[model samples]
Target: MLPNPTLDQLQVFLAVAESGSFSAASRALNRAQSVISYTIANLEAQLEVPLFERSGSRQPKLTEAGTAMLEDARRIVSDLEVMRARVKGLKEGLEAEVAVAISVMVPTDVMVDVLSEFRERFPSVSMRLNVGELGEMIDLVASGISTIGIGGAIVKQDDSLSIERIGHSFMMPVAAPHHPLARLNRPLTLADVREEVQLVVTDSSGHTKGRDFNVLSYKTWRVSDIATKHHLIRGGLGWGGLPASLIYEDLQTGRLVALELEAYEQGEYPIYAIRKISNPPGPAAAWMLEAFRASLSRCPNLEAFKAQLPFNRSKDAIAAE
Candidate 1:
């Protein structure tokens, strides 16, 4: 009766078949030629079939059964290699999976750069991104729905959370080309701003309930997310603050014009890297934070924004205040 095949026996069979000779297989496997020949002989005996056709030639030919078995043997070995690598990664405090919550307030360029690098750096770690705004973003980290949160620290932080202000996204008030605010070439007065409709991104989460930031216009159109607010502004629905990275093309193409609001000075909204205090960032998460910080620091076109700003507030000044 045929016996069950062993991994070693199968491996030896594959090596011999692939290398075309028992001596070559031994050289490739760093085993004695006799050991390779014996393993194959035992494997063939266990299977009740000859795997290699031996006509006293230096190179043995694979039988039909041996060739057919190669595919399964190769697959099993490849799967084992992957499992070994994953186990090693786990032992090194590497995260099996990571979910990063990036705030929409973070510059788009920074996100793309950091994420691109992260994929290369942590090839084995599975990644998920939760892009949110204001408190909704923070809530994800606090609730452990996201591994880390990258956005504004709008809500008062709690002991359950750890926050670090990494960098800032330059907030510019923008209006579509044909909007009333866009037509006003000079700095707009408080009355002018209050009179026009302002599109405000509201925090849907209860963390910052009823709180308003820079909502100047009494006639405000509230939206629950930044993308919606951006879409509204683009359709000439209302004017609002958008990250410079988002409007870079719009401004360049004259599709959207940065408004010169006397009542509202263009400033940097503090971007933070936050995570749960209990579940501090793991190796992959930690590297991602640094990657984000470095990328955000080099966010494109501070000079371009400076040249284009009707009035500028330095990031340091914004920090101090």
Candidate 2:
């Protein structure tokens, strides 16, 4: 096995190489010149290599081996400094890792904004993002699989978690322009909706078992993700509610049409940042929560919803997925 050089010796060697002389290295390290020279000699002896040239009457110069090791020494010292800083931050209530469960309903632009800022603000802290739909977001936090959850929960929220209303997801029933619902082109009654199919987003987590939201139709189809449901709706397969942010362009281009229902119409659902009361958010988590709230409120769809349906104060489709 190769002999190991001590950290002190490597540091001394680095100082000498950087300063170009033993006396300058001693002054920089606040050590005696003899001591600095001795440390370098011991390091070279341990590694079995000549670290400096000792020619008469000139400042000390690094040999090829010394020059090569200089980069390695700098890297080691830099890594040590980073580790020390991270540990210091951790001790000061900064989370070592921030794990968040996100809902698809949260405006995609808001999600992207919060995530990008979080990375830049907390370079030392690790991050985990789990994307889920509806109740799955809340379940991840309740089960301690995530540090916090960002979304709305339909069922009576469990008392064990702390729920903070962050913003709103403007939801409304929509269908393809050519669908039977749009063909009627007037206010729809419950009977008219029940006769058609409704596409519902189903979560495998079953966190909200035995609970159904906004299911007016007797003939319903369950799908796993919002993308598939959106695809089917665009294809005129069925009608269902979607968060306005996701289908803004669709609405503008008439790929889908918002339906006017006399009996039932979906509206704003409160988006929440949920966390277990026992596992409170650390510094990083708190920062993200604030960022999410401020950013979500400015969502173009949420603003559109506010303007388009000023008179519509309908209670949202909580698990409307």
Full-model lDDT for every candidate: 0.80, 0.82
Taking the tens digit of each residue's C-alpha lDDT, what string does model 1 give over 31-125? 99999888888888888877788987768988898778789888887777667766888999899999999888787777887888988877778
- Lowest lDDT sum, 10 consecutive residues, model 2, at 312-321
Q: Determine the C-alpha RMSD for candidate 1 after optimal superposition of all C-alphas.
A: 7.8
**TM-scores for every predicted model:** 0.73, 0.68
lDDT of 2 at 148: 91
List, in order, the clash count of every candidate structure.
Answer: 0, 0
Which candidate should be chosen as best, given lDDT against the real structure?
2
